[model samples]
Target chain A: MTMTFDQPKTRTENQTRTGATVEFRGLQRSFGNVRALAGLNLTVGRGELVALLGPSGCGKTTALRVVAGFEQPDAGEVLVDGQDITRVPAHRRDAGMVFQSYSLFPHLSALDNVAFGLRMRGVGRAERRARAGELLDLVGLPDQADRYPHQLSGGQQQRIALARALALRPRVLLLDEPLSALDARVRLSLRDEIRRLQQELGITTLFVTHDQEEALSLADRVAVMNAGRLEQCAPPAQLYARPATAFVAEFVGVMSRIPARADGATVHVLGRTLPIDGDPAHGDVDVLLRPESIEVVAAADGSAQVLGAAFLGAITRLSVRSAAGTTVKVDVPSPAATTLPVGSHVELALPDRPVLVAPRKEQARA
Target chain B: MARLAMAVTALRGRIRWSRGVVLLIAGTYFLLPMVCSVVFSIDVPGQGVTFDAYTGILGADGFLDSLTLTLELAAATVVSVLLLLVPALITVRLTAPRLRWVIEVVCSLPLVVPAIALVAGIGTVLRWGPDHLADTPLYDTFIAIQDPDFPVVLVLAYTLMALPLAYRTLDGGLAAIDLKVLVEAARACGANWPRAVLQVVLPNLRGALLNTAFLTLALVLGEYTVAAILGYRPFAVWIVGIGGSQAEMSVAVSVIGLLVTWVLLLALATAGRPRSARTKTTAETS
Candidate 1:
């Protein structure tokens, strides 16, 4: 049997296919007293996959649903390929949506479920069946087409749901937490498979998720949202390195808040002066430093004492308490951290580059 | 190990005692009446037990006519109840969900209004309708509604009476499936409102439809109050009318009617098993 997981040419071929640009302009939606989407503006380029990442109740789902035509924004316009489609019904918008639940029609066989959209479009029986078969094969489930939904595993059912959504050849694909229900291992594999299929189709896609690793690993760009507003929208590396707000910095990865003295374009922390990115306030502020950025050295006269250490394959994370009674975590190579055990004294140093610093009042528990 | 097994056996005995007691009580409560009916139907005080009373009804006059009419009314009741409830339930659930309690109350109104009181109200309307509508075109409709071949009034009354049962069954089935999501999914696939309801929603509710239909069938088959009061000789009324003359045969007929109803209910319960489960069983057997 030939393996189909490694093919790469489909991404480019899909780029030339019918990938439409989707734009959300000044969208606002509210439910009772809670605002779901507050003047949201976002643009997804042709054939681009952008992940809308946020915690639950962050309105990331509401924004995605607005694009799918399942929800209407109270005061904004949604444009597909520069044409206003705010008033269009969901089915007529040419947007394929895969829900969080499997959402398969329990009455239909897997093949029939995949072919449902085509049937709705009035396609001929034989033609819809043939196309559905091809889609089943693409999702690596050709032999299970005759099985009912209950007979299939959860992963298999989701694959059929994906095929059903794609059977219509929609202009935009909307996936709302599609992998959140699966087991961890299945979630990883299926997410990669979905990403591969999406790239292959080259469809402009909006993927809503609460998983940071999933968003970082799968999307061409990630839009981090909070309280019905987009906090930062950038590529994964840029989002991680230079978050626009303190919320994004805390949400994206592990970072320790260290008290620091801030001046114009510079912050003093750990007895070292470091240039600060963006605007640096001239007062006491919180400096956010990644664990890897804090260099740890073993010394008898060290100011910090190692509290605990955890060996994580290639790297070891050390928790140390400094002389100022502030606890900070540091990461080093396993071989390097092996020498620094609990109760050992260590000194902490800072990186020379510019770091992200925010006003002290903005520092809240993530 | 012996002590552990003994403890498990004691627990099992306790569970079996509770289950067996409940089963025995239920069996006696329900079965004893049917057993008495069978014995009363077959036993002749002066003669040995025989099925002469059971066979006696085959040759009785008006037996076939009443049975045929009741079956037709049951069929009409099923069709009318489904047409009225399914569309209304779907529309209220998918669109104005705030009106759900109102719809539920309306569907169950027949249950609160006793059958005798409801029949009295309908009787007044039927009697006063022609006089009030005199000289108007609607006067003829009142006369036409009392057609003997197929009494529209009887069918109407039965439909209203069957509403609560049908509504509860359909609503339960709808609750089992995500109705809004299914409809939206279908609409997202290019189906219109009616097509989505017919194609996607209805197929998923096959079990509910069958249950409602059977419940209505059993109801209309045995209902005598409205039909007898309206001066229409439906099967139940005919059985009562014959009981005044031939008591044994009528009792036998009642036993037969009970058997037929039991068969229908058994079939309905079995048929309500999901198609996927049925296919799995078939495949295993094959």
Candidate 2:
């Protein structure tokens, strides 16, 4: 009967007890002509949740599989807690993995399914069942243990998969797109559940997902991969705020490509010369400005017009075509939704700080 | 209301007629022969609804022996094929992919060589083995295809025919399984490869195994050419012994063969039912 979602500490820190560290040195994999992973190097510190975020076939899953030992890298080593485990078989590596399908043994009751790994280890029936019972309780489903896997909802099945993985108390946890199968609300709630559990157990977990919002919301750091290469690896906030490459900027979060020409000390934008971040590589430049950095004011005394408006619940995304015929997307609070109409003149404001800029050729389509 | 109801009734009549036409043709083609067999099995020419055909076959001196031998051969083919195909498939995939391909080619070689070729070639070799096996009546009597010894050579030959189908079906089953789940789950629990294969791999494939076994059974039972050429007697060859006059006997064997196939289909259905708990229990318990 207790409502716990509003509590400050309920979501992030109760379960991540003692996290483990994972290190990969020069991991390489290839499939025919496709170079899936080439000399990839990454280190995940203890108690940190790092998301290997990339589009499909970007070598993120390959890296996760290699760590799980489901795949053997063509070269390089995988080390967990300073132990070389490149050759260690997946099951012997002491890492718990939760698959996207929630691959629970469909024929076993939830309780017995959770206890399967322990039973295989020859743990006596009484002790294993007791431990399994405790895990089911922890995931908030003690009553459903007797039900078969098919009898549970998608969310419940996922919780059982997690409990089964945790049953063995593995050092490093591997989650392969674990919540990509759920409905939006279920996904949000389960993500919070995962964040909470990781905090409590402090288990060193490697999560692989194609979702950028998921990576930003959950991980300590996000590693972006493109065509089997790691483009950038840093804290989520830092990576989102200051992406190392044009790919990182476009892939990590939303941004708009605004045309600008570098004119020595100043750049030409907004039909007026303005200054932005970095020294250019000469020629025409393209500056990447975040939508949050742009503001709309009434025009005539205005510099822009609202070309289109879209309602997004709490926010309204406005498509504004500037005086120079450049289109930009601006997100504003939903309360301003009715006030901003198409063809209405509006003035665009820029923040005082430096904005991310690159050459038109260097800027990714955003 | 009257017009709508009349229209609906006419529409229903049209629907039934369209459905009935296809059923009528199919039923006449397949069931007429089957109905005739039942009628023949019990008819007494002048007398109505009699069991003379049944008694006549049972009363015939060697008919029981031939029937018994046919059943024996079917059982043998099921057993031998199981012994050969399952292990062969297991090792084939477990080996290198290249080597597995070679084994696959070898298993399928029988298809290229006809059963008659196998019988002719082996029959010739056996005839030349130190002494001509055909010189003894044992060779001649065993060739009576429904004799107990018919399936020895019969099943062995059918194994070749049955193997490709069995291997392919089983291979499909093995491919469909989440092998990683089984192997990793077992390994984490500390079970080794053989144990994992037995407990995990084989059970999931029970449906395919049973299906192949049944198909193999039917094939061995009905096999005529190889048994005839090799001078052995299977049910098909034995039924041919009545020289087209004992159409009733032939009909009887066909009916039994059909029933066996159905039994096997049921077995296959049973095998596929989810038993992950009990299966795991028995696997661990033993």
Candidate 3:
């Protein structure tokens, strides 16, 4: 679905282009013996929003911090607008960052907090306040200008934080898990709001989040990291449909691993042979299948019995165990799920699309 | 039923009878001596209820000098200790957190050392400095710190004595707020380290700073052992010295000093409250 917002009118007229291209070249950071970023390289195009999606301790936040100039990379150079700022101090860098924690200055009123950067830049009081007021209105919190951060709700505080980050008109907006601290409903709404604002302002942004859904929904491209390395960087549809690595396939979405035997370019699973998606492997292998990709039908003499069913709004996920003791989860419409009760026999089938297969040992490691 | 009724009544005031009784006893214990002191200061033996003792405090010998010296020492101690501890604590918290325990131990070491021992050690150092460095340039430095007008030595001692209290207060404040996040946010907003600390960190720590200052001030004002043993006449020592000559006047001065300390505490508390809280308080009252 396409969502749109009016262009921000308060953006200064002189600032014709609001976004700047950011490049990370061989960025490496280490905390004692632990390597947070190892020779990482990625470039964000002007007006592009790239979400760094990874599990906890996967170095997504570390990468974001390195770009914000908070953490010094052991060996890399970060360039914004083609200018190297690796050695620049955090305050000197023009990267506006919104942290995961409640980062609004508790002592300042909302308006003053949003105007802080302009104040640091020596902007006149009247101008900064007017700009701050406009930004507050953009965030839909104009009436909350006089309130302190403690007086605002969590979602409101984050909205103010977003306004504060944008107040400086920074070249690149860095969000380090900004929505992770909020509740689920707020998270979804703020996720859309952030995407809308980013699009409206046309600011190049680096959003780091552990949630794949958030990444896929909001980012132009999602960079999946695993163990301090970029496993894959692609558009959400491509990343989901054609994951470059086993880690990416498993991490980006839920994948059911069914033991299969591979011969050359095809693998046999569930009494059917399928073409291998990526690398051709022989011998014992595990084929990964998305829950929705498997077609499930109730049959009186089916080989599998339904173990459990979990209702998830429109779709219900059913856990089924084959006669061979292999358990696979399948997603079917809630109406069809009602017909397949627990202990009922079912049949599963895969489509003609190539299936991702990983060696049993490699799948275990991933 | 009677006990239950009394307990419920006490609970409505947010103080149980047991707590109320304990507070009443403690108040009496602390206030009885001050009441007697006031009575003694006002009631002359043969003359009825004279105000001469209270009024004569300003005219008393060495009163103004001692008071001035005490205030200076208190101010200097507050500044020096905050200067020494604030940045150190913040740096340790932000950069080298593992070393926080070492600083805590060092700051708290003064508490274990007795005042007499500390003064004796200072006296030994003072006597040793002149004897060993008589011909050296350092001899003059030793004499300057011991100057009676504003003894830098006493200020140093009081700063050491105030370290534990100041560290705990500042540490508690730092703990309550996410110091790293706040500083990073300020830095992202284009504030340099000094500006971030001065404008963001210090304002947030206003309560802790005021509390540390008050504790140091009270400590400096009431300290007699170190100053007296070191042969300095700060207010506390002056009060003791006057007690030998005029008992009623000395008691009156002590009462007034206590009252002044309470007033200063109240002022600091009101000043340290967050602006929003203060505004709300004013609004509520209105």
Candidate 4:
């Protein structure tokens, strides 16, 4: 059967397909002395894709596990569709999970692996087989139904895993670094396909990953976490542009710390003043600038000297040392790095966009 | 070129000598006893070559009885060991992984305990059993242990002795697959513990199960010490008793037993191989 993914309307316009709302309230989990989730509270809106993004050991996965009913929280409740399901067994929770390792049953063919959940639910064999075939077609792997896991490629295995997870038509989907195990090229294409499918189904999904770019690209809302707590939760653009805390700003993207002085809502950095979100005490602080915001020009009388340059396809990242002996990274187009090679003097300039600032550290002895 | 040819010839000569020596030793070790027994059993010197002893087994009174009893014992041992082991190992591996060392130690204790020593210990235990269960339903079981028609004690003893080999085979199979992941996946698909074990775990372990069963069968067929001491005439004990009055018949039975065990082992080796290995060539042709 050929399954067509022809949902051309935006996810918001396709609001006719309703999805469940999932909420984790004050979830606390600990393994011995290490706290996995310290009072983590977050809610996923109906038909929205929320990503829990963090470094390893930041409890992003633990939060997803609690929602999936694989783990029990020590002092909290998980509510799905506004009803508490904290005590529900994993099999009864009606949540489908796609693990990082594919986790396909090796002995079963792809069709059987996809049909497994329906079989367990007591669906007729013919009906389950038809449904599984439709799911495989949906993932663009219709002909791979008869192939075993070992007979398929890594990418094919992951697609089969995803199809299996969606076969049950679960109310909520949980993905734990599903694309991290693949190569770079496959990872990109598969992630886009996943986003399209998730939107088509309109299932409220919680994807956990340490890759910031993936979280930003696939999630409707990205929740950056650190130390078992959410640092910020917002749309990708907002989380990248206007991070609520220093940790969120640093984790979401690359940021360069430059000495600056804060005067009310404006901060002065690199011999220029820029606007910030809120009014802070008029004192010395460190300004955080995105590499794209910093411009570099080669000039003999410049105060900064280029220390190194790395050509990264469209943009070249340059490491420069300021007159005060502090290192700052700036990204420029490829052609610009050729003229401003290593040891070349260059002037650093900031754009009009706002920059984040934190308290300045004590100067290191030069 | 001449020197190189001489060196090559020397290497070939050395390889041939070693291969011939090994072949001769192995051929003698395996075939010598069968050859001697065949010759000895058939040679009724004054009566010339005859098949008397081989034919005598058919007319022997207890031959069929002992053989049937041993077959029954083998079946019981295979089933009881599987029922006792498969679930316990799966549970221990999946749920209480910390108890793995203890299970391994207990299963392997039979290997260290000699068969004669085990029989002596079992005799003492059975002697104490009657007095303790004199007024209970268990008294009937103690009495049934002495039955010669279908001895249950031999089954119990064979099952215990087969534990170490069965455990190793099953553990090897379990190690080959990601048991925890498979079981958890089954559970997530809405399977209960029993359903998961029966349908998911056991089917994947077909090879291990067959290997353990056949190994237990072979062990039951060949064991003699405990049955002889218990005054039970199992196949092994029966063959020895026949030897007292009819030496040639005993050798004939021994040859049959050896052939039976070889067939079982051969079947075990091929049973668990991947199905694709057999069908790939056919698919290629089609």
Candidate 5:
């Protein structure tokens, strides 16, 4: 998707097809005893914004660093525009990166910081400054050009950092938790701004973030990683609904695991027999269900009692305990949730969607 | 209530008085020796307060040569020490951070080894080099380093002596800013490692670099034991050597040397401050 913002027409015209495809083929890295990337193979299409989402120490940042050439994979190759750049030094890679910390050169003003790459490339002083000024305007901080990094607010520093990263018109933009240092309001706004700029520039970007909402909202695809491996790589809605593994289901969104007995193609969960989503698990298993998928009805003789209710704007999450001692969370419309207060008994029902099941042992560990 | 208020006021006044007394004592303690030195340098037996000792400083034999040699040694020491430590410290910080303690221990080793002992070891090596390397081409290296015109061995010794201070100041500067992030950012901006260190790292470490240079300059200017023991008549040794025949001249030169060191330190301090900070200071002062 290409977007045209209020930026100077000439500059936008110059960036028409700037993005390059990035592919990580069997990338493997290890730090002493701990493996960071275990034979990781993934590809980001041209102009795609793929977010590497995982918990801390899960190697999301390591994978992004490998692509940016800050790190060399132990055994695999990283290709940009189908050219292997696995051994290229970071300076020659032409991959622009925004760091989690405030990486703006504190000694330089915002304009100079943005123009640093142009200067390194031997661009003339006047042209570099003019281009930097335009980039500052793009990030909505044109007036802050003369201000040093220490003088600007944290959010403004990040905006300049973003402009600086974009100044090179790099093949791929690597965002390593760029908004993680900002507060919630700034993070939300910058997240949108990054997405808008990425779309406008059509730059292929690999954003590493542990924030599930940020990944789901901004990414064309979210690659969920766990323990040095990609759990699942899919679109936001698909990854949310049809998570390939139990780890992906739990990591991507809120999921509740309840004991179930699977036989053949169906699983009997919460007094309802439903078709299994993936490979059928026989005998005892745990079924994973989204809170919104399970419907709760206020019933006097229901087997489950509403343990607690959390008002979440449009929907209220009700934590209910069953007679069989399994706690399940169900999301109901706030207005209806008022009728099912804590201590009130409710009957739960599932729609016709196939439910994913994991072995009971894994559920116990989770 | 009035009595209690009076008591508190009296207590505050007593504290202020004590602070004043402490300041006066410290000021006298530091200033009295310098004041006596200046007085002794100027006072003559019959001419009352003659300025001849100060005036004769420029025309004194071996004065300018020794001072120039000391400055050259200082410049070479500063360059050698910074060149050696900056890259080593940065590399240690960036890659093998766990080996940081190793650098620290090595740098700090010079501080514990007495100057006399260090000089003894160097003397032994210098003496041994001539005998062992007499037949080899290295025989000239021993003679070349011992050149009284500009002893390179002194620069080597000064570099070793300045390591601990240089390491601390640079390490402190590195700690104040995130070195890894800055270098990575510079690299991402298309700056190679050398460019990154030269432009980004060094600029941010301006204060620390100046401080390290000043300390090294001071050590070279004031050092007497190593140069004296090694039979080199640098500025400090010359000042001490003339004490028997020209006591007032020696004291005058010492006083002038102290003043020069202070001026250089002040100049460096002013230069090291950020332009914005200097402007702010000027505005506040004005």
Candidate 6:
């Protein structure tokens, strides 16, 4: 960890992919007796944006703070490039951070706020201002350099915060729920803006957020954490499509548990035993099916009664009750989305995608 | 019926008018004595109303010295309070919670122990002995009874009364701010705590601190108990002494104290507060 922290390398766009990298090694931190991070481990590759997706109190922000050196880890180390910064003081660590509040200096103009870090590092006023102006322009706030924080809207302040973080060219940027306070419209707009900036700079970034759409859309890989543990760390599609555990499957998106009797390779659900993905024994297990996978049809052939339906633009979502009284949702195109009314029979089909399964109530992690 | 309604309306209007008159009369009654002091300050010593009272005040033997002494005392009090109060208030803000309460109680203890009692209880105040302040001791402070620089003693008495109020006002101002904005903003910029406090947090507290300073100065200007009891030659005491022979000059001194206090308090009241202290929570999720 120490070795990596000392020599964080960012290639000057010589290649398309190389820039800052962060590696967390058995990082552990605690607040008094409450363990915020219990042996947490994750890595954000150079130029890669990784979102630490988790529920509240799941230590996702704690992990980010530890990496940023705001909160010291009781055990293990945080390595940027190859140097360990577990014991590094927050200031000397020189990591860029964008906070949930956008934390823009209230008294400073947008330009000066962006230039503040450079000035702190002993950069001259003229050069720092020029650089700050450039960064603000990069963030699409060129003419707003003179605006005080209150004069700008919420989105602009966040953009300024990003520019300020990038001012000193830190190897890794930590965003602690940086967009958690904006309206939905602004959030969507700024999320794309942040993604674009990250790609352009090729700077390693660890974004912490509880929003699954944000994590899925912005990150190259999503590290889903729950209860002080990393449940799954993989590309967003893989996290949603092939969740490693029941916790990850539920956390990433909506899922349901079903009674399944598993025999070595195949699991039987509702009298249909096909190929199962998990390695549980011939007993009851919970299965997770994505809404997109299953389709409802006429009840004569595996049909079930429609319990309810939700109309999402471009698609319609239906929850159908099977013959065995199990309800499952299926999302179909808007044109064919009309499902059987409540109490009307409908058919449910189990597609060939590998379904995630977990042991019953008393079972351990899958 | 119409004629009776008109009479009732007239009665109500008359009652309202009389109430307003009563209030105006009472307000004037309360202000009359203070206004009379200002009016008397201009009354002539011999025959007519003139600036003689003002002139005679400066011409008096002890009055001039004490006037100089009073100005010096006010200055010293302002300086001392700034030196002691500002740092103490700041320390209270940054210290750990456990120790913060202890320090607060200590600063407030001076107020709890009445200034007169504080002066009386201390062996150093009542009886002068060897190895005292400058080998001289008189009551609360040596200067109050013997040093002739009455302003110094008066100012010391002012600190005893004003320190707690200053702390409270500043603390209230500090409480009104969102401290997290400063902390997180500084941390995000790689600023250590000290730099953040100096450049960010303290600047935000300008209104509060300045208000405290002006208030302390005003309190120092009006204080008389510690000076009078300790044999200090403060302006208020001198004004009291001269009221028998030269009432006009004494009134002039009273008017000066009132004017000085009013100005200081007005400055405090008009100080500008931080306009941008709210936390800017940008986006909830993105």
Question: Which regions of candidate 4 fall more than 4 Å away from where they truly are?
Answer: A5-18, A279-284, A361-366, B1-28, B38-58, B279-286
lDDT of 3 by residue, B181-269 (tens): 99999999999999999989999999999999999999999999999998999999999999999999999999999899999999999
For model 6, how does the per-residue alpha-carbon lDDT over B14-61 read when each residue is reduced to its tens digit? 999999999999989978988888777775556767887776776787
Model 1: per-residue lDDT, tens digit, A1-366? 123423423222233446799998888999889998888888999999999999898899999888877788899899999999999887788888888987888888889989998898778898888878878988889888878888999999889888888877788988989999999999998998888888877889999999999999999999999988899999999998989999999899877778889988898888989899888578889888788988999999998899998887899998888766667778999998878989999998886789889777533322
lDDT for each residue of candidate 2 in A8-125, tens digit (9 for 90 to 100): 2322333544567899899999987988999889999998899999999999999988887778899998988889999876657777778886577655678987887777667788
Runs of candidate 1 exceeding 4 Å displacement: A1-17, A298-311, A319-327, A335-345, A362-366, B1-59, B96-98, B281-286
Relative to the unseen true structure, what is the C-alpha lDDT of residue B130 in candidate 2, on a scale of 0 to 100?
28
State TM-scores per candidate: 0.90, 0.79, 0.94, 0.90, 0.94, 0.83
Scored against the native two-chain complex, candidate 2 gets a DockQ of 0.24
| Model 5's DockQ score | 0.60
Model 3 lDDT tens row, A60-153:
9999998887899889888999999988999988889999999998888889999999999888898899888888888888788888888789
Please rank every candidate by DockQ, starting with the best.
3, 5, 1, 4, 6, 2
> Per-model TM-score of chain A alone?
0.92, 0.89, 0.94, 0.93, 0.94, 0.90
Per-residue alpha-carbon lDDT of candidate 4 for residues B51-160, written as tens digits (9 for 90 to 100): 98888887897999989999999999999999999888998998788899998999999999999999999999889999998999999998897788888988889989
Best by lDDT: 5
Deviation (Å) of A111 in candidate 1: 1.1
Instruction: Give the runs in model 3 whose Cα sits over 4 Å from its true position.
Output: A1-14, A361-366, B1-20, B281-286
What lDDT would each prediction earn against the true structure?
0.87, 0.76, 0.90, 0.85, 0.90, 0.74
User: DockQ for the candidate 1 complex?
Assistant: 0.58
**DockQ (model 6, Cα):** 0.36
RMSD of each: 3.8, 6.9, 3.1, 4.1, 3.0, 7.1
Model 1 CAPRI rating? medium
